[model samples]
Target: MPEPERKSKITASRKLLLKSLMLAKAKEEWDQEIVDKQAEKERYLSERVTPLHTSGLSLSQLQDLCRELHEKVEIVDEERYDIEAKCNHNTREERPVEVGDWRKNVEAMSGMEGRKKMFDAAKSPTGQ
Candidate 1:
């Protein structure tokens, strides 16, 4: 096999070409990692928040809601995948999970306030 001639121009171009290829490969890897992370995060959030409404609903109603949410979640997941696939993300991170039911807080306060209101109402304006 004959050895190929190494032209100066070709050799010079190959370095830039290889460098650009390396950069592109690094960018592809970074982009895919970002998308994978985002998909995981979205999966975690969906697991956490989307099922709360079913806690108070009836069994049949809950089943219906689950079905609807499943469809919606699928759409959201697909769109998220599509968007993340095309995105050039420079930043990414996972968040901690935390949830609090404020309605229960309000209900507790309302129960307390009701007694106070009743007591005030019972106290007549004229204490003859």
Candidate 2:
């Protein structure tokens, strides 16, 4: 009887199959990571306090809290106004008078007449 044909060992096909399987496994892991991140986000949102959290407070308690918050806001506004006024006053007082003098000096040195006067002064003898 003739011997049965032996299967040829093809390393290239085996390597390709392995690479495909590894890529599939990596894709599955990436999908799971995305799912986990979405679930975590949902959990965080659910855990946050909403407006309904104050539902347990009585109407009188809520009213009193509101009144207290209004008082605090008014006090803060007054303090902020005072601070702004002081800052404005300090800024006005801190301005240097020399800035105006410097500007005048710069203007004197800029024009053609100023350059002619400068040349004349330079040409004059030091003894004069």
TM-score of each: 0.32, 0.35
Cα displacement (angstroms), candidate 2, residue 17, comes to: 44
What lDDT does model 2 reach? 0.86
- In the range 5-86, model 1's lDDT, one tens digit per residue, is 8767667678999999999999999999999999999999998775465467789998897898799989999999888865
Highest lDDT: give the candidate number. Answer: 2
Report the Cα lDDT for residue 71, model 1. Answer: 100
lDDT of 1: 0.80
Clashes of each: 0, 0
Give Cα distance to truth, residue 69, candidate 1, Å: 20
